[model samples]
Every structure is written in C-alpha cells, then in structure tokens.
Target: MGDHQIVENAPTRAWVLHPDIRNFGGSGDERPRDPARALEEAVSLAHALPGLEVVGNEVVRLPKPHPGLLFGTGKIEELKARLEANKIELVLIDGPVSPVQQRNLEKAWGVKLLDRTGLILEIFSDRAATREGVLQVEMAALSYQRTRLVRAWTHLERQRGGLGFVGGPGETQIEADRRAIDEQLVRLRRQLAKVVKTRDLHRKARAKVPYPIVALVGYTNAGKSTLFNRLTGAEVMAKDMLFATLDPTMRRVKLPEGGPEVILSDTVGFISDLPTELVAAFRATLEEVLAANLIVHVRDISHPESEEQAADVRAILASLGVVEDTPQIEVWNKIDLLADPTARLNAAARSDDIVALSAITGQGMDDFLTEVSHRLTGLRTEEDMTLTFAQGKQRAWLHEQGVVESEEQIDEGFALTVKWTETQKRRFAAL
Candidate 1:
C-alpha cells in the first residue's frame, strides 16, 4: 500500500554477458582478476531476483575495441557461434557499451545484447515498484533509448497523414514518437522535482526529531535488505539477488542498550559497473546516502569480488562527495558462508572500522551493534550520578529518556543513577 512496502509482482530474467570485457576499473590489489568471479557474482544476484532465472550465459573474446561495435568482426562471428551453441537468446555485457555499440552487437549476435548500462536499467526498471521510482526509471530509460532509436525505428520513409508532413518522409512517425517521449520526459522531470521537494521537507521534519540516519550502502545483492530487516524487524524483500530494492526504505531501530532510536535507511544497492544513465537518474534516491549522519558499508563477505565491489562502492560514494569523513561502519555480512570465520573476522578487524556479521544467522550482530553504538554515542565510560526526589523533573526525565545504569535510595531522598547523551548531560546540568 505504501512505497516502503515491497511490490510482489513482475517476472525478470538473468541474461549472460561475455566475460572478456567485464572491466569496471583497475584494482590495486595484486589478486588475479578472474572473469569467472564476475559470472559467479552475477549468478548470486539472480538469487534475489523474483520470478527470474538465469537460464544461460556466454562470453565473446573480441580482437580489440571497435568504435561502433566494441568487438571486432571475427570475434563477433565467434560470439554468434557461441550464442547458437548455448541456445542463449539474450547477452549481457558487464561494461559500459554505447547505444551504437549495443545496436550493432545485437544485430551481429542475432539476439538481445544488453550492455552493463542496459542490464542495470532493466533491473532498475523492474525494481522500481513505486510511482516515484518508476518515474525516475522512466526518465533514465528515455534518456538511454533516445540514442538507440535508429535500431527500433529504421524505416523512416512512410510519413503521410500528419499535418507536419511538409518536412518530407524523413520527419516520420518514429521521429514524432521520439519528440513526444522527450516532451513526456520533460514533464516527468518536473514532477520528480516536486517529489524531491516533498522529500526534502520530510527530511527537515525528520531532522527535528534528532535521530541519526545510518544508511546501508554496498554493491547490489550484498545482503543490505536482510541486514535491514534484522535490525528493524521489518520484512523487506531480502533474497540472494541483484538490485532487489530500488526505492529507499527507512525505519527506526532501537539500540541494544536501550539507547536512543536511530533511523536506519536501506537504499538501492550499488553495482560494480553501474550505468551512468541510472546513476544520474537515481541521484535523488542516492542523496539519502549523502545526507545520512552515518553510513554502514555492507559487504558480502563470501563474495570473491567482495573487495573489488567494496572499492566500487567507495569510488561511487566519493564521486558523490560522500567519502570516509562521514561516520562509516563497514559491515562484512554473510560470514556464515565462510569456512574459516576467524580469518574473515581478522580481515574485517584490519580495517579497524569494520564489523563482521552474518545477517542471516544473527552471528556477530551484538558486536556489530556495539560498534555502531560506539560510533554514534561516543560513550566511553558509564557514569552513575545521584539525583534527589526534590529534582522530580530530572528523575522523570532520566526514567523517560536515559538508560538507568543503577538506582539507589539515599538517606534524604531517592537517588537515581543513569546514562545519558552529551546533549542530555548538558540539559541535565542546566536543570
């Protein structure tokens, strides 16, 4: 019924991509870059996909990058052969291929060829269950499709009935449709601007409540939803799939030690080679991460490309001006899948700002919460302060707001000892 609620509809498919060109960026790590790892990651993403199956996959080794098609002629032939051999009807490229390249590749392969951008867009399109999310996806899709119109509307010599036909057959139906879609995109942008203003107003209202927003950001299918559900007790869509969530969901979560409730926001997950079009389109959604007071960088500890994916998320966040300066708690999720858990723990400990936890099994959740508590409250030591019944207001405030570490009955009056925030301490002092 609400945008926060998950939509239980839609069928999706996991298409295969040629592993040879699966490059997002250079990793400084000396570990060998395995393309099989990319394919495995892609399969993991498919697990979270509802009503979808990765029926097949294939990789094409091209001679070099061609300006128009990205792959050379001989490699294109090999690609065709592989597609036929594998009975694969759809191909996905894990790199940023231009619209021209996409069209040319599809023509050469004789099947749907989706570049990294296109695949991401398709996932975004399906994940966009809300009206605003749909608007954002549509805006991005239109921007992407505008350049590929030549493939879908090649026959431009049939215009006749339109009043603007004076411009000749070149000004055809397809061109008019493109113009109309452009106009619609303008309207959609305006509408989304209004929605953004509304979200801004809501954010300001939230600020008055004084809850720090801790956003979970990482590569897609990194168990962010599962972690969010575990922390908030909200049954969000959590599966072993990619891009399962497109809309940002926020919920109030209680701290382990009865501390102040914090706003935990689960945003749309990031990917290794995210499309620029989707990035620009979903900038409004990602603004949540930028505005958050704290960020939890959730990583799939079991993923082979976990380090690389972490780097990708970090790079994207830096590009968005959301760097390490913000209070960041790296959460290494899915530790249950690891054979040597302590090794993973040691790896996480190396970061000094990281917490190892398995969202599925509730392992290390307590330690993770403690780490978050330290980051948020900066509570170094527990203090026991005595207050008299004469300070009835202060006692009541402590009972209502602060966590009572200890209580005692003094000679003259009731002595209540409690733990409070720094601001709460200042308020208490003023009282």
Candidate 2:
C-alpha cells in the first residue's frame, strides 16, 4: 500500500503460512515443492521485509483451496484464535489468494493480509534502489493492483454523477480508479522506454570492448551475491536473506593468465511462482542474462531442498528465454555448511558442469575459477589480419583488446597477429 510503508520504532508482528496442496490437478509435470522447506522460505521472505517480526510460521496442508475463504471455517477459527493470542498484526500467505478469499480472511482474522504476490511486491518496492528498478517495481505493482481493484479500495462502491451526454447516470469509483491506473501505467511505460534506450546505448558501448559477460543466476538466497562479491571484490549487499540484492550489479573482472577479461553480473534472485507481472516488468533488467556469454547458476548445496530449488531456478531461466546454446555452469555453493567432508569432496568432483564451493569461507574457489577460465578459453580462436592506414580505429581496438601478439608495419598499413575468441573477432569486425 502506498508503494511501501516503513515502521520506525516498532516492528509489525507477522505470521507466515505455506499452503501445501496435495494434488495440482492437470498442471504440468512439475513436482510440488516440499512443505517444510516452503514454510522455511516463507519465513525468510517475511524476515526480508524491514520492520516485520515473524512471530510464527506453519505449513497448512489443504487438499484444495476454499472458494470463499482460502481456509475452511474450522481452520480459520483455529488460526484466528492463534493470531489473536500472538497479537499478529499481519498474515502472510505463501500462495495465491483470491480477492474474495483475501477480504474474507482479513475480516475474520482482524489483521492485514498479504498473499504471496503482494508480499513479493512489497519486498521489491522496499529493496529497489536504482531508478529503473524502482520504475519496474511500481509498474508491476500497479498492474497487480489493477487486477485486484474489485476489493482493493473501499471507495470502489461509490458512484460519481456525470453529464447525460457522457453516460446514462454515472461511473463507479472503481472504473475511475482503473482508468487512473491505466494512465499511470502508460506514463511509466514511456519513461521506461527512454531509460531502456539509454541502457541499450550503454550496452552497445560495452560491446565495443572485448570483455565477455558472465552472469550469475539462481534461487533467492542461493549465494549469488556472495559469489559475485567474492569474485569482483565489490561491496554489493550479500546477506542470507531472500531477495537481498534487487538491483543488478556489474563489474569487470580479470581472469587468470591465458583467459580474457570478463564482466561479471549479479542479478536479482529468482523464486518459485514469481508473479507474472514482475516477470514481464523486469524483462528489461533481465536482458543482462540474455546477453551473457556464460551463466553461472549458484545453488545452496547444503539446503534440504537444494535440488528442488535448482529446478525452480531452471524453470524461471527457461521462462526468461535462456537458450540451450548458452554455456551454463552450476556452482554448488555453501559447501562449508555440509558436515561431511567426503560428501563435500565428492560433490566438488561431480561433473564438468558442476563446481562445489563456499563463497563465505573461500573453499573450492580456485576450482570454480579454474573451470570458468577453462570454459572461457575454450571459445578462443587465433587469427591473422591486415589493417590499412585508413583503418586506424580497428588497429587501435585490436591493440586495446590486448589480443595482438605481434605487429609489423607495412608500406600500406600494419600487419598484426591476434589471438582472440569468436566473440572478440566479431566485435572487431563490426568495428
């Protein structure tokens, strides 16, 4: 509500609930997430919001969601009594809740209610720092609010008088509010277009250089930011909380010898059932992953639901249109959390596409870096080229890339021997 509300002195008492559905009808072949782990994730999400004290959390097993209210009468009464006893000011549901259901539950429990989407939106609104990030979150929130206009505002039931020429009697307040939201969305889209154009120009400028982009992606709290900070030595916020890093961060990193320079990108973490509005709104920001030469998927190797979390991350990446050809490596992070040394060592030696490491304690970092360097070097190709005196820009670019091993001055121009990757060669050719 009102973008985000910040409480200064007192934190709001909140309770988290994760609805564990037994059967998903005829949906895709995806397995339902573990209930216990889902409850933990929900609690973490509640903790991510500032000034929210998560007093309690539980996994509520339901065969199917009730139409009028998400929970049955008995369950609702039980939870209402518990919430009253605990003095919870807010209830956070870890799954979708219909507008009618949400309203009914709120009335019954005598507290504010936030479904999964709303809670995620609040977190994004509070964490957004950059101008683009803020705009995207607002746009997404507006879109979500537009759909819930039926029960979102109390004034929606009021009718405004209008001239006979315009309408028979008048328009409802909800209609006017929807119109206003539409106008706001249009304005935001225009501003976002200009921002996107500027970002595209910046991307083109980066393309002139020979540095390859390596983007990190994974589920929330999977150690992507930690690994990014460790690799780039940047002070990006790296915490054990969900969605801690909302804005994408990029830094130029020099690889080991025989490896070309790379631009490392730390992106917002993905979560299971991320709102569709957010997915569409954040597409511009996620283009960094689309343009990447390599994607490193960081995973919390020690988590109980690590594989399930990995599946969720992969699903989101696929939804984002990540191509099959893009080289990907899975970093099994938080190996230090594993109690068994043999298991850690075995996980580290698993496969070519997998590298086990601990971003916090710096264990297995060398192996991770070595694998990255090896993969990047594998894309290199040596080439011989001649640049005429008229092609001063190309000559300068080749030299700037540090790819020119030898150069000779000819009568007409310069002859250079360059060992570069296919990407670098194409960029130089374009120049």
Candidate 3:
C-alpha cells in the first residue's frame, strides 16, 4: 500500500508475466516452478486485487535473466508492443525482480510494475484486519521499499546544498527517505513488540488450561477458514480468494461425545514462493503454529497443483522451525470439487493417516473429529517424579495443569505420578 500501487478512478488494466528461467537456483534439488501453473497462479494473484482487470497473461521463456532488464531487448520490445496494444497500465511479474530490473522494465514497457513480492505485499496490506497484522504488513512493505529507494524514486536522488554555517553538505533525498523508513520501522517494531507481548500473555493464559491447540495450515485458499467454520461454527471470511484470511483466528471447540476440549486455530494459508520480507514480518502471526499440539495440513486435493502446494506448506513449516515430532493429520479437503469423491475417499480411508473430506459438505467430519480426539488423547504420556519441598512451585504447576494424577508423601517431599503432553513436559522442564 505504501508504494506498491496507486488508487485509480477505474479498474486499472494489468498483464501478468512468468519468467521461466532455465536451471534456476542451480542447486542439486532445485528446480523452477512449472511455467504453466506458475503463470496461472500469477493470474489468480492479479485477480485477487480489487479495481484491476488482468487483460492478458503469458509465460515468457528465458534462457537466462538479463542483468539490466529481466527480458532480452528483443523479448522486451515484443512484450512492450503487446502491452501497448492491450492498453495495459500495470505489469505483474510472477517472480522476484531486482530493483534495477524493475525500473528498467517499467520504463521499457511504459507501465507501472509490481513483482511477486510487491504484489503479495499489496494484497496483505489490503487484507490485514488486525492491529498487529496491519503493523506487520506496513513494516514488511517499508523494508521492501527501503531496498528499492534508489531505483523506484528517481526524484529522491536530488542533493540539497548545506549553508556555510551548517554541515558541509546536506544529505541526499534518498538518504533522507531511507532514514525516514528506518525510523518508521523502529516505531512499528516497538508497537508490534507491545502487541506481541499481549498476545503472548493470552497464549500463556490458554496454556494454563489443559487444552491442546490444533492449527489449520496449508496453501492459501485451501478451505482452512471453511473447515474451521464447519468445525467451530465461527464465521471467518471464507472466500475463494487467495489470502482471504491474513490474521490467525482461534476458537475453542468441545468435540462431540464428551471428547477433549481443545482450541482450534485457523492461520494464514501458505503459498508457493512466499515473499522473503513476509516470512519475518508474519512470524508473530504464525507463532501460534509453534505452540500447537497438533497441526492439520489442509490441501485442496482437487487442484492440479495440490502436491506442489503441499510441498510449499511443508517447506514453510520447516523454515518456521515446527518440530518434526508434532502430530499432524493430512486433510485432503475440497473433495466436493472432485469428480469421484467417494473413490478418492475410499483410497484415503485405506490409510490410517489421511482424512479425505469436503469441508463444505461436512462429509467425514465425524471421522476427522474422532481422529483429532484420538491424536490429542494419544499425546499424553505417564511419568513418575519425586519433588523436594523446595520445588513446591513446580509441583503446584503440575497440579494446576491437571497432570499430577497421584501424589504420595515421601522423604524428599512427595512422589507423584503424572500424565502430561510433551509440550507440557517441556514447559515444566523450562520452569
């Protein structure tokens, strides 16, 4: 929102491009995204924004990216002609573009440009509804803008001469702008720290209750909010749009048949090529996942890119440091959109792990709930410990967590039997 796009009276005509670079990353396991699917996703991203008409899109094959310009002079001229013919006012590139390349490309095509990171930032800025979410997005945008100051703002290169009585020379406009952004970032970080502290307090309060937290995480628009609403009956925005839910939403749900009472969290959906700036910005928003006792990796099994999307989610989870031992259930969601959902469900049922169902139709919800209860109840492990009189605090903590089952008076202080989760055990160890 800061410098991503300008407000216009009418829908701005936009075109999407995916630069398909060969041998990208060059690592042993690294490979470029599927060009066709990547282009489709870029188009979808463009469509998610308001007041913009994506007039056309293409996958531009690139042997290698040009340094000054992303595309070769020949391809640039060709695309420029196409954009001119279509009256495109904005160009959306489906990958990271260096600031220099961005400016040069915009100048070449005679249009405003937003690369993958910028486009995502714009959407996040527009969709962020919470105070913390807004501040995080603004900070991310500012951080991104700071890197592009010299390239994005030609006018900011102006130098102001200092008076003889003052310092020898005044700072350049770029220096002033970068300093201003840095100051704003510092202020935002202070505000965000306060907000995060409050959230941490809330999380701590929740921890005191013996309820396990189950987090819904997956590729964006994979029906996380819909599934959450189906489970908890909370009306979170469940649009089909990408990033429909930015801030994490949590609700406490009591499973049917007197099952365990647990907290259900619906988090921001993951996506392929998630911007680097956002990963750091939204860490607090996603810290809930770190606290989760169980994670439900929801996947839109009906989509062609389901496997790819699932991989992306896993990659992000790994990057976020989600422990491997945490119990996770793979939810093959949106089966209603599939052609033969029953067959697919049958295949999934054969596996003790995956649960295939449509969140909208409520199919197999009972199984899902039962699986969740089983997993949560199964998380408890029994142990025996002898606490000294000096350890009254830890003993009290265990009792408060409802984990101390039986205590016997002993020489040290008390010998106790406890049933608790790994998370609780870890907390006790920390204490």
RMSD of each: 8.7, 4.9, 4.5
Measured by TM-score, the strongest candidate is: 3
Q: Each model's TM-score?
A: 0.75, 0.85, 0.87
Model 2's alpha-carbon lDDT is 0.85
Could you tell me how far off, in angstroms, the CA of residue 383 lies in candidate 2 after the best superposition?
1.7
Best lDDT goes to which candidate? 3
Predicted candidate 1 versus true structure: per-residue lDDT over 1-431, tens digit per residue: 24235446633344666546433344535453576776666655544434655676655444346889787777778767866776665676766677677767777776666666666777788788766788999999888888777655432222223344454436466689799889989999899989888887787667556566789999888899999999999998886667777888889988988665789989888876566777788876778898676799999888877888899899989988885557788899999999888988987788868899999999999989988877777732357776666888877766654345678888867755565455457656887
TM-score of 3: 0.87
Instruction: Name the runs in model 1 displaced over 4 angstroms.
Output: 1-15, 19-33, 42-53, 81-87, 155-175, 347-352, 379-431
Residue 159 in model 2: shift from native, Å? 17
Cα error, residue 310 of model 2, in Å, equals 1.5
Q: Clashing residue pairs, candidate 3?
A: none
lDDT of each: 0.74, 0.85, 0.87
Local accuracy of candidate 2 as per-residue lDDT tens digits, 1-431:
35447666788999999988777554646677778988888899999999899999999988888889978899999999999999999999998888888878987987889999999999999998878899999999999888777666532222232323253324476799889999999999999889888988788778666677899999899999989999988989988789898887899999876677899999988888787877887776678998888899999988888888899889888988998777899999998888886776786586789998899999889888988998887876677778899999998877766677789999989988887777667788788
- Please provide, for model 3 over 1-431, each residue's C-alpha lDDT reduced to its tens digit, 9 standing for 90 to 100: 35455566689999999998998768637766789988988887887888889999999998889988988999999998999999999999999899999888877887889999999999899888889999999999999999998564642322222224243324476689899999999999999999989987787677677788999999988889999999988899888788888888989999998789999999997888787778988886788899899999999999988988999999999999999888899999989899878788888899877999889999889999999999988898889999999999999889777677789998879999998998789989999
In each prediction, how many residue pairs overlap at the backbone (N, C-alpha, C within less than 3 A)?
6, 0, 0
